[model samples]
Every structure is written in C-alpha cells, then in structure tokens.
Target: MKRVVALAALAAALANSARADSATSQDLSKGYAKFSEQGGQALYANVCQACHMADGKGAAGAGRYPSLVADPKLEVSGYAVALVVNGQGAMPPVGRMMDDAQVAAVVNYVRTHFGNRFTDAVTKDDVKAARP
Candidate 1:
C-alpha cells in the first residue's frame, strides 16, 4: 500500500512538472512573437547590409552606394525617407520592401548610427506619409 501511494505521488509530480514545462514553452513563444528591433539593426541586416555594409559607410565603384555617414543630403529626415521610399538615381526603392515600422527603423538607424549624428528620429507615420 505504501509503495502504491509513493508511485502515485511520483506520477502526480511528473504530471505537474510537464504542465509547468508546457506553460514555460508557451510563454517563450509569445515573447518571440512580440520581439522586434526598433533600432533597425535587424532590418538593416536583412535589407541594407549587403549594399550599405555593416559600417553604414557604403561603397563606391561601378554602382556607387553613397556613404550614409556625414552626408549633407541626410540633413533632413524627409529627404532620407523619400529616398528610401521612392528611390533615387542609382538606388532602387528598397524601402518599399519594408512596412512603415521597418522603414522607420532603418531610416532612424541610418540617421543616428555610423558617422551620422542627426538627432531627429523618423517615425512610422513619416514612413507612411512618404509612401507613394
């Protein structure tokens, strides 16, 4: 009788542990769903990293990707947003590939990081407005 009780208690404990594990797994899944990079680093990795390089310094040559750092054109956030959304000259409208939030992130990222130090952040609303 004592052995039976011990086995039952062990079984119940295992069941409770399984339930706890399942709950923790569900919470982790929810956390992943909510995750996003507001800093734009992730979006840049997926989109701009190839052409712009990780440094944001850009490249020059046959198809010159202009430097995002210390560029006079980026003085206005609107100009950068417009260029990203609409494309200009040699660059394609790569900004169209991203939604408003992603666009805002990358624009804000470029404006603030690298050698550029423009303080104003590009909002998702600004990205939406730039869309054509």
Candidate 2:
C-alpha cells in the first residue's frame, strides 16, 4: 500500500542520513560508523528529533513513540543510557551507530531538555559500561 511504501522510503532515507553523518568516524572494531556530531543539541536534532519529534513529545500513528517531555523515566540516567545503548521494544539500538561520547551527548540532551530537568549528566564511562 502507499503507506507501507512511504514508510519504507522514510526508513531508507533515515538510514542513509545516518551513514552520511557518521562517514568520517568509522569504528572498524564495532563494524559500525560513529556519528560525527559532537554537541548534544546537534545529535538530538540530527537523530532523535525524527521519531521523538522536535518538541520531544513523541508521536502516535503507525507506532507509539514515548514522549520524552517531562517523562519520569528520564529521572534515572542509567535507564535512559541502557535504553539508548540496548534499545527496547520498537526502538532500534541507535547507540550501536554512535560512540560512547555520542551516546552520552544525545542522552544528556534528552534528559536536560523536553521539560525534563535531570541535571546529573550521563558520562562517556556510563555509556561505555552500558554497551553490550
């Protein structure tokens, strides 16, 4: 159907965009390229914003993407870190395509933004430990 085709196209585009964004930071050991985005805001804008929405309120249609806005789950930084590193349910393990620092940056951005006010940061060591 048209919806299926459109979804497929969107997935392909996102995959391609990720690849391009991480082209310069290939991690041969992991067999995946690391995202080149350095800042938390940039990483969020380039990656997480798509599904979670620009407002971090998430979306609902074909699937249920949980809202990051003032979500209590983000209060525990480890939960967010592990989820990013390992994923859960419908969410893909996007952290696999990112380095520890990138993962930390993105997670920190999400926690600090979207009306969520968890001040404690997710360090690179936290992300490294969270990785499978």
Per residue, candidate 1 scores C-alpha lDDT tens digits across 49-116 of 77888877889887778677777778799998998889988677877666788888888888777777
The lDDT per prediction is 0.76, 0.85
- In model 1, the runs with Cα more than 4 Å from the true position are 1-39
RMSD of each: 13.0, 11.9
State which candidate has the highest lDDT: 2
lDDT tens per residue, model 2, 17-95: 7677656666222224655567789888877887998999898997788899999988999999998888899788889
Estimated TM-score per prediction? 0.66, 0.74
Runs in model 2 deviating more than 4 A are 1-32
Worst 10 residues of 2 by lDDT: 27-36
